[model samples]
Target: MPTKGMSPVSFSPSRASPSPSPSPSHHSPSSSPPTPRKTLSSSMIAENVDTAESIIRKWSVEDGSSSYCRLDSVFANDRTEAKDFLRSVKNIQSAMQFFVSEGTSSSSEQLVRAQKLMQMAMKRLQKEFHRILSSNRNNLDPESVSSRSSVSMSDFEDYEVASEEDDIQVTGNSVHEIVAGDSVSDLAMADLKAIADSMISSGYSKECMKIYKLVRKSILDENLYYLGVEKLSLSQIQKLDWDMVEGKIKSWLNAVKTAVKTLFLGERILCDVVFSTSPKISESCFAEIARDNAVTLFSFPEHVAKYKKLSPEKMFRLLDIYDSITDLWTEIESIFSFDSTSAVRSQAVNSLTKLGESVRAMLLDFETAIQKEGSKAPIQGGGVHPLTRYVMNYVGFLSDYSGTLSDILSDSPQNTRSPLPESYFSSPTCDDGSTSALSVRLAWLILVVLCKLDAKAEQYKDVALSYLFLANNLNYAVSKVRKSNLKLLLGEEWIENHEATLKQYTANYERMGWSKVLTSLPEENPTAEISPLEAREFFRRFNSGFEEAYKKQMSWVVPDARLRDEIKVSLAMKLVPAYTSFYNKYRGFFGREVGVVEPVVRYAPDDLGNYLSDLFYGTGAGSGSVSSSVSSSGRKVR
Candidate 1:
C-alpha cells in the first residue's frame, strides 16, 4: 500500500478445478512468476480487496450529493486521509493484478469484484484531481507557484544556518526563500502529486492527464486573455489605428514578461513536479497545455511588425517589442525545451526577425523623409529648421535604444558610402567594435539630416544668413547628441570633432557678416599723415559701414544662450579695441578742425560695446539704431 515503488505486480489464482478440501488459493499453471507477496494468503488478498472497496465506495459518484466528499476540501487538512485513499486504490490494483495472473474460476470472480472497486477508486480520484485543480485555483496560480518552486531545500537550510550565526547580517536571501515558499500552499501540490502518482501507477494515466489538461489549459488561456494577448491577424492589425496598435503593443510588453517568466515557466515547473515519476508524461502535458497560448502571445509581435501602415514614429515601439523578446529569449528556450513546444520558440524567433525588418524599414523611411523633405521656405531669422528638430529628436530617441539596435543591425545591411565628404560625416568612436553597427547607422542618419540642412541653407538669399542657418541647425543637432544617450554611443571624440565643425560655421558667419565693417577702419598704424578732409571721409565710411552691419544683423538669431554669448564676446574682442584705437588717433584731427567731432565721428568706443550687445537677439530690422542714442562722450547712453 506504500506509494513508493508501486509498480504493478502480477499474481493469479489456481485453475485446476475446485478442490473439495477447500484448500484456499493456489498458483495456477498459467500464473506469472511470484511477487514479493507471492505467499500472500487468500484471506490477506480478500482483506486488501475489502479495505479498498470500503474507502472507494464511500466516495463513489453513485452516492447522493449530501454525502459526496470533495477531495479538494478534505485533502488539505486530512493529508492522512489522502494518503490512506491512495494506498487503498493501490491495494485494489494489486488485488486485481493478482487475480489476472491466477487464471482460476474463483480468482476470476474475485477479479471482477476488485476491478469494479478499482474503477470506482479511479473515478473518485479523477473527480478529486479536477476538484483540487478547480477549487485551489488561487493557490495553484502560476506566479505564486513559480516563486515557490524557485526556492530549494538548500535555500531553507542556508537560511537556518545563517539564522544561527551570532552577528550575521541577514541579507534577505535566506528570508526570501522562506517567503517564496510560503506564497503558495505546498499541501495542495502534494495532494495533486499524490493523486497523480497513484492514478498513473494504477493504469489510469489517460484519465488523470485528460482532467489535468482540460483544467490547466483553461487557466492558461485565461492568463493569456488577462495579459491582453489577442488573436490578431495581419489584416486586423493593419486596419487598427496607430494609437490602438500602440496601446496593444504596450500591453503586450507587460504581458510577455509575465507570460514567459511566470505563467509558462511556473506551469512547466508545476507539471514537472506533479508528474515527477513520469517525465515524458509531464512534458507532454505542459506542451499540450501551454503551446497554443505561448504561440499566440509571441505571434502578436509579429502581427504588429507585419502591419502595412508602417511609420518612422512607430520604430521605438517596435524596438521595445523586439527588446522584450530578446531579453527573455534564454528563459523562453529553457521553458519550452521540449520538442513539442518548439513552435513557441520558433514564433518568438519569427517575431524578432519580423520586428528587426520592420525597424529597419522604418529607419529607412525616416532617412528617406529627411532626404526628400521639400519644404523650400527658409526658416525666418536663420533659426533651427523644423526638419532639423524632427530628425535630431528622432535620432536621439533611437540612441536610447542603441543596445537593442546593435543586435538588430549587427548583420543588417548599411549604406557605408556617404555622399558628404569623409571629414564631414566622420566615423563614430564607439567603446566596442560590436556597437559599430549601431554607431554607424545612427551617424549616417544624422549625416542625412546634415545634408538636408545644407540643401535648406541654400534657400536663404543672404550668404551670411545661410551660414547662420547651418550653424544654428548643426549646433542644435550637436546639442541633442551631447544631452541624450547619444553622448555615450557617439563618444567624446565624435562630439569634439562636430563641435570643431560648428566653430568653423560660426567663424564663416562672422567673416561673411562683419567683414565689411572690420575693413572700413584705417590700418591700426596709418603710414601717411591724414588731412582733415581725408579723416572726415574715413569717419563717414566707418559710420556708414557700422550702421549697415548692425541694422542687418539685429534680426539674426543664435538660439543657444552660451553660443550666443560666446559669439558676442568674440565679436566685441575683434571690433571694440581696433575701433577705439583708430578713433583716439583720428578724433583730435576732427576736433581741432571743428572744435568738436560730434558731426563726423558718430560712434564712440563704448558705443560699439552697446551695439554688439544687442546683436543676435532676432529683434526686427525696424528696431531703433544705436546712432540715434550716441552721447556727447561718443558712447551710446543707455
Candidate 2:
C-alpha cells in the first residue's frame, strides 16, 4: 500500500523506461581552463537537429511521435551547445504534448503554470520561426500546407495562442496552424519513452527525480484531456516492457562502472539514488531496482582469477574502493527499511552481512594476487614496501568494519584466539585496549605480516645483511603497529615478543661480526712465549684482521640511528678492554727494527676502543671515520 495514491510501478509496455529525453547531463564545472569556443551555423544546427530527431524517432513508439513537433534547433557549432540544442528539442516536445492537453489538464497551480509557460515560450520561438519562413510563406497557399493542422484564430482561442498562431499565417489567411494533435495517453507514453532514453543517456545522475517529474507533469496534462485515475498502475495500463527494463539496467551498469573506477563521485551518486524521495514510484519497485544494482556491483567476481581481473590495484590501492562500496552498501538498509522498534535493522543487517562476505571474498582474492606476484619475484629483504603500507592502512580502516571479517571466521571449529598471557595486550606499547573478536583478529594479522617479513629477511645470503634486513623490517613493523589502532589489539605480549625478536637479531649480528675479532686476541699468560717476533706476529694478525673487519663492517648499513648507536656500544663493551690490554702488554716487547722508529702498531689499544664504539653509526657506515671514531670512543686514541 503506497501511501501516496501514485500509479502502480508504471513502465512502458513496448519500450524501456521512457526514452531518455535529449538533455544535458548533470556536470560539475571543470577546474581546467575554458575550452575554445566554436561558432554555430544554420546548416550545423539543421544537421544536428536531424540527427537528434532520428534518434528519438527510432526509439519513441508513441502513435504520433513525429507529429509532436519542433524541438528548438541547436545552431551553435559549440559541442555543449549542440548537445543542449538536442536536449532542448526533446524538452520542447515534452512541453508541446502537455500544452495541447492544457485545456483539460489538472488544476495544480504549479503544473498548470509550467505547461502554460512552455506553451508561451514555444509561441515566441514559433514567431521567430515565422520570421525566418516569412519570405517563403508566399510560395504556399492556405490549403497547400500538408504537415500542419490548420485552425482559425477564433477556433484556436482555447489554447490562448491565437495571436501567436496568426503571425505564422499569410496576412488575413483564415488558418491558424498547430504542428501536432496527440491524445493524452499517446503523448504520456511517448514522453515516457523519450524520458527513458534520456535517463539511459544521462538519467542516473538524477533518474528517480527527473523521471518522476516528467510523469507528474504528463499526468496533470492527461487529467485535463480525459478521465485519469488517481492510482496509476503500471501493469494495469500496459504490459511492463523489456525496453524500459533494459534502459534501467543500462543506467545501473554505467553507474557501477563509474563507482568502481573512481576515487569517490560514483559512490556519491549511488548514495543519492538509494535515498532519493520518489513519492510517485512504488517502494517495492525501487527496492527491487536497487537490489538488482547492488547485485551487479558486488557480484560476478567469484574466484581469485575473476576478482584479480576486476581489480588489478591490489593490497592497499583497493582500500578506498573497498571503503566506498562497503560503507555505502551497509547504509542501504537504514535508508530503505529501517525499523525503529526492532533490535534488528530489518534489511540492513542482512544486506551488510552479505556485503561483508563479498568484501571478504575480494580480499581473499587479493591475497592470491599478491602471492602470485610474490612467487614470481619474492618480496625483497628490506623494510616494508609502499604497497604493504597501503595494505596496513586499509586494514586500519577495516577495523571499523571488523564484524564483517569476524563473521567470515565464525565457522572455524578451533578456538580462534590464542591462549593469552596475563600481560597480553596489557602494556601501553601493545594494547589497543579492545577485547572484541575483530581486535584480536587484526592483531593476529599484524603478527602474521611480521612473520612473513622475517621470512623475507632470510632470503639474503649474507648473514650480516640478513640481520640488517631483519632489523630494518622489524623496526618498521614495530613503529607502524605502535602508531596504529592495531596497537589496541596487538597487546603487550605481541609487542614484548617482537621486541625480544629484535634484540635477538642484534645479538646475532654482534656475535657473528664483532665477537670473532675479540676472541682472536692472544692469551695473557705470563709463562707463555714472549719473543718480540711472536708478539709482533700476534700484532700483525690482529692488525690485519681488525682493520679488514672494521673497514668491511663499517660501511654495512644500520638504518635506525638509535639502534645503530646501541649496537656500537654493545660491540665496544666486548672489544675495547681486550684490545687495550693486549696492546699494553705487547707494546714494550715489540721494538722498532733498525733505526726506523715508526710505531710497531698501526693503532694503539685506545684506538681499538674508539673504533669499536663508532661501528654501524650511519647510513654510509662511519664514512671512513674508523680512526676518528676510535678517538671519540670510550678511550682517547689519537
Candidate 3:
C-alpha cells in the first residue's frame, strides 16, 4: 500500500522496476462530491500539508524563487532524505486533490498552500535533474553507458523495497565500475528516469525533454567532432588533395566503427531507459540527438565518392570505406531501427551504393589507362614492360579484396568485348564452374594488360628479342598470379595454361635466337671422311656464327632468376654435347693436317659452354669474362 497522504505512483530509484500505473480510485477527481460527515479529519489533512511544507521548504532554492537547491546531491549523501523529499512532494499533491474532490470550501486555503509547496518541490527536482546530467558528463559517456547490460526488474514492489543499502550500492561504486559493472551507470540512469517520470507525470515533459535534448545533443556533437567526422560538401572534398582526402577517409574508417558500435548505440539505450514512461519522447529524443550525426557520418563517404578525380590508385581507399560500411550493415540497421532514424540508414546505404559505383568506374578507368598507354619506346633488353608491372601489380592487389569485390561486382554488367578470346574465360580460369563478375572483371583487366604487352613487344625491332619480351612479361604475370590470392581466383589450371604459353614463348625465342649458330654446324657425321679444307671451313663458319649470336644475346635480360637459370640450362643442353663431340673429333686432326695460321678450331667445347653461360646477363661482355656457372652436365665450363 502507498503512504497514507502520498499518491500511489511511487517508484524506488535503486530497484529496477517498471513505472507503476496509478489506480483510478487513488488519483482520479471524484465525479460526485463526498457526503458530509462529522468524523471528517480536517486536522489530519492540515497536519499532512504542514509536514510536506516543512520538507519542501528545507530544500527550496530561496524563500520562494524559480531556482531550487539540488536534491539528488543531497540524496547521494543520505538516501532517506531523498525518499522523504519525493514522498513529501507526492503528499502535497495528494492533499491538494483531496480538498478539491471533497468540494470543501473551508479547506481551499489549505489546498492552495499544498499546490504552492508541490510547485516548489517540482522546481527543486528540475534543477536537481539538470545538475546530475551536467555533473556526470564523463560518467554518462557513451562508451561506458553502452557497455552496461540491460537492467532486470525486481519481482518485489519497488516503493516497498527502497533501502539505504540499495542506494549506497548504486552510488558508491558506480564510478570505479562504470564499464566493468553497471552500478554507477544504473544509478545515474535510474535517477534520470525517476526525475523524468515525476516531471512527465506532473505535466512538465516539455521542460524535461528540452533539457535532455539540449545537453545530450551537445555531448553527441562534441563526441562526433572528436571522432574526426566532418560534413564537407562534395566540392570541398573534390578540392582537397589526395593525401588530405585519404587522411580524412582513414579517420572516418576509424571513427565509424566506434560511432556505430558504441556512441549512437549507447545514446539509444540511454534514451530508452531514461524516458521509459514516455516512449514517444524517448524515440524523439534519440532521433534528435543521434540521427543528424549518423547521417553526417555516413554522408561523408557519398561526398568522397562524388570526388571528380577517379583514378585506379584511389580504388583501394574507396573499397576500404565500402568494406567498413558493409561490415557494419547489420549493426547500423539495428541501431537506427526507429522509423525516425530511417534517413540515417538510407544515408549509409546510399554511401555504399555510391562507393560501389565509383569502384566500378575506377575499374573501367584502369582498363582505359591500359589501352591508352602511348609510350612507344621499347623496354631495354626486352625485360618486363612498365605496363605489365603496373597491371599485374594492380590486379594482384585486387585479388586481396576478392570477397568485397564479389559483392560490389555481383550486379555489374558484363563487358561486351573482352581483349582476350572468349575461350579464356570458358577455360579452367573460372574453375568453380561459376564465374563471378569480379573474377571475370579482374581476368579482363589482366588480358587487357596482356594485349597491351603484345603491342609493346612489337616495338622491339628484333624478332628474337620480341619473343624474349613476351616470354619475360608473361613469366612475370604468371609469377604474380601464382604468388597471390589470384591463384585461388584464377585457379591452378589458369596458371598451368599461362605457364604453358610462357614455355612456348621461351621456345620461340630459343629457336629464333639460335638459328644461325645451330645451322652453322653441318649435319655430316664428324667421323665421316672429310678433307682438311672442309674441316677448316666448318670451324671458320662455326666461330663466326657463334660469336655473332653470343654478342647479340649477351645484352638481353631475363630478370626472373629461376626463368633465367632455366633458359641457360636448356640452351647448354642443346648446344654443349654436339659442339663437344665435333670439337673433340676435329681439333687434333685440324692442328696436325691443315697447318692453318690460327688453330682451325678457334674454340674448345668448354670455351663455347663458358660463353653460353654468360648469355641473358645484359652485360654484353665478350667471352674474355665467363660466369662461374658450370655446364648442364655438372662439369665446370673452363
Candidate 4:
C-alpha cells in the first residue's frame, strides 16, 4: 500500500464482456443447434486477475500478512472459484479455504484485499487532491473551498470528512473538488471586499489596517493552522516581512472601509445592543470591548465629533455604558492601589474627569436647550434620570478620598513658592497655580452643585463664605507684597497720588454698601424675584467688577509717598474692623474680655493722633487711656 506521502495511480478499466446463457434441456434432440454464449474474454479475465493480484499485494503489505499465497490450497476446484472466493472471505473461514475465492465474491479474501486496496488508493488520491489544492490555492474558490484547509490536518480532517460525506458528488469527482467553482470564489471575494470597502468608507480605515496586520501576523507567525501538516509553533513559522505585511494591511484596510460603509445604515442598533448587554457580561469583557470601541472611535477626530453630534437620547445610552466601564475601572484601581492614599486620589480624580466629560457630552443638548430658553423653561424632564444621585454618591466618595489625600500631601515638603494656607480660609489661589488641576476643578464643581441644590444650598453657604474670606486674605497678602514694589517703581513723589485713590475706593465701597448688598442676598430668592434679563445683567456686573479691578491694578500710576500711606492706612483699616467685630461677637468665649477687647479698641482709638504717637513710640497703651486722650483732644476720628 502507498504511504500518505506517496503519489496516486490512475485506474482506467476496459469494458467487460456480456454474460453467458443457460444450457438447453437434454430431451431436446433438435436443440443440438443451441450455441454457447460469449463468455468473458481472456483479456478481460487477465485484467480481472491482475486487478485482484494488485489488491492482494496491497493488502498483504498493509496488514503485514502473506495470506494471498494460500489461494490454491483454499479453493481446489476452479469451476466454483466465485463461490469459494465468497466463502473464503466470509465471517469465519480456515486458512486453507481463504485463497480459493475469485475477486468478485463478497466473502473472497481477494475481494477483502480489493476493498482495502481501494481504500488506500482513495486516500492517496485525496492526499494528491489536497496537494493540488495547496499548489493552486491562489486560484482556488474561497467560498466553495474550505478555509479550514488552512487548519492543520489533524485538527480538521474529521470535520472535513464529515462534510464531504454529506455533500453530493459528481461523476467521479470528490465533493471538495466539485465545490470549487467560480461562483464560490466570486461570492467569497465579494464578501471580503465588501467588508474592507465598508471599513474604509466608514472612516474605520485604521481598524481595517489593524485587521490586515492581525491576519498577516496570524499567517506568518504560524498562529494560523494549515492542512496536511502539524501545527507550527511561533518559532517554526516564517517571519513576516514588515513591508509586505504593511502593504497587505493597507489593502485590507481599504477593503474593510468600503465594506463597512456599504453595510452601515447609521443604525445604532448594534452599538445599543452591545452597550446594553455589557453590564450583563463579565466586567473584563465589557472593559475590553469598551476600550476597543473608545480607541477606535477616538482615533479619528471626525468620528469623535460625529459621536458628539448624536442625539441626546442615543448619546446618553453610550454614556451609560461608559460610566459602567469607568466604574469597573475605578474598582480595579481600588483593588490595586487603594491602600495608597495618593494613588486612590489620583484614580478618583481621573474617574471623575472621565465621568464629567461623558456627562457633559450627553447633556450637551440639554444644556443648549436650557441656555436658549433660560433655566425657567420647564426642564425637559427626560435628561438623565438618577444622574444627580449618581453624581452625589461619587462626590461623597471623592470628598472622603480628598481628605485622605490632603493628609498624605500635608506630610510632603511644602511648595513654598505657592504655599497653601494652614487653614482653609487663610487664602484663595487660582486653580491654575495648583499642581492638581483636577482636584481644584472637582472642588469648584462640587461647590457649584451644592450651591445649586435647594436642600444643600444652606450647607454650602459656609463654604462660599470660606471662599470669600480666603479671597480677601489673598488680596491682603498680595497687597502687602505689592506695596514695597510699587514704592520702588514710582519713587516717593507718586505716593500722594496712590493715597488719594485708596481713600476714594474705601469711601465708594462704604457708601455703595457693597458688603450690605452681599449680606442681604441670602435673605431673598434672587432667581425668583429677579427676571432672567436682570439676572443676566447681575452676572455681567459681577464679572465687570473683577475685570475693572484687574484693569485698575494694571494701569495704576500711583505717587510713592501716598501709595505707602494708603497701603498702611488700608491695612490698618481692614484689620481694625475685622478684629473689633471678632472681639464683640466672641469676647464671651474667652475667659477675660480685657485681653480680647483691649487689643482691638487700642487699634481703633478715638484719638487717632494719640494712638499714632503711641504706635510710633512702640508703647502699648490701655484702651481706656487712649479713649480719655481722644475725648480730651476732641479728636474722635470715627
Query: How does each model score on TM-score?
Result: 0.83, 0.44, 0.83, 0.21
What total of clashing residue pairs does each candidate reach?
3, 34, 1, 35
Return the TM-score for candidate 3, rounded to 2 decimals. 0.83
TM-score of candidate 1 to 2 decimals: 0.83
Give lDDT tens digits, candidate 4, residues 1-638: 11222222232221121222323334456655423331233234334545444443432323446554422221122323322222222211222123233222322433344344433332222222223322333433222233322323232112121121143332212212222233433222322322333333323333433333332222211211121112222232224343433343343333322212211111111111112222222133223222322222212222222332344434333333333334344433432221322343343345334434544454444434323432322112111113333333443333333333333233333222323222222122334443342233333333333233323212323332222222222233224323433223222333443334445543443333223322322124332444444543443443344233223222221223333234335433532343334334433333333645222122222333233222211123312222122323453222
Report residue 60 deviation for candidate 4 (angstroms). 17
In angstroms, how far off is 74's CA in candidate 4?
38
Write down the lDDT of every candidate, Cα atoms only.
0.75, 0.43, 0.74, 0.30
lDDT of 1 by residue, 327-360 (tens): 9999999999999999999999999999999998
Score candidate 4 by TM-score against the native.
0.21
User: If both were scored by lDDT, which would come out higher, candidate 2 or candidate 3?
Assistant: 3
Q: Which of the predicted structures, 2 or 3, would earn the higher TM-score when compared with the native?
A: 3
What RMSD, rounded to one decimal, does every model reach? Answer: 8.9, 21.0, 8.2, 26.6
> In candidate 2, how many Å is residue 8 off?
20
Off-target runs (Cα >4 Å) in candidate 4 are: 1-106, 136-181, 184-638
lDDT of 1: 0.75
Question: Which 10 residues in a row give candidate 3 its minimum summed lDDT?
Answer: 1-10
- Model 3: per-residue lDDT, tens digit, 554-586? 789888888887887777667767777777776
The lDDT-based order of candidates, best leading, equals 1, 3, 2, 4
User: Which ten-residue region of model 1 has the weakest summed lDDT?
Assistant: 5-14
